[model samples]
Target: MPFVNIKVSAPEPTKEQKKQIIAEVTDTLVRTLGKDPAAVLVMIETLEAESIGKSGLSLEDLRSKK
Candidate 1:
């Protein structure tokens, strides 16, 4: 079995987008690693902007600067 974990900060993905992500990831693993589609697991974790930081700035702060 192959496990794939993805983390995204804030503004969670829509249901359709998430499904596309899972499908694409599974196809990639199947084609590249020869993993069975049924055996491939994809997990997406959406974290709050406050929970993720970079360069001493939280994701929320960083996005605000944009």
Candidate 2:
């Protein structure tokens, strides 16, 4: 089994985008690693912007500056 974890800062991905992501990732694994589609697991995790920091600033704060 192949497990893939994708983490992104929220507002999170839309349902359609998530579906596309899963499908594309599965296809990639199947094509590149000869993995079974049924055995590939893709998990998407969204973290709060406030919880993620970069360059000494929280993602929330960084976005607010834009």
Candidate 3:
């Protein structure tokens, strides 16, 4: 069984996007890694702007700098 964890800090992704991501990753793994699609598990997490950062600044702060 394959267990996967996914995290996103941006605004909530649409359900369609989630499905597409899982499907694509699962298919790729099944083909390349010989993993079972039905045995795969995926977890997604969403965080606030302040909780995520880059270059020593929060994502929101980075945008303001650009």
TM-score, each model? Answer: 0.95, 0.93, 0.85
TM-score of 1: 0.95
lDDT of 2 by residue, 1-66 (tens): 999999999998999999999999999999999999999999999999999999999999999999
Ranking by lDDT: 2, 1, 3
Point out where model 3 deviates above 4 Å: none
**Better model by TM-score: candidate 2 vs candidate 3:** 2
> How does model 3 fare in lDDT?
0.85
lDDT (tens digit, per residue) of candidate 1 on 1-66: 999999998789999999999999999999999998999999999999999999999988999999
Give residue 57's lDDT in candidate 2 (0 to 100). Answer: 99
1 or 3, greater by lDDT = 1
Q: Residue 59 deviation, candidate 1, in Å?
A: 0.8
Model 2: residues with Cα > 4 Å off, grouped in runs? none
**lDDT at 48, model 2:** 100
Of the candidates shown, which would achieve the greatest lDDT relative to the real structure?
Answer: 2
For all candidates, the clash counts are 0, 0, 0
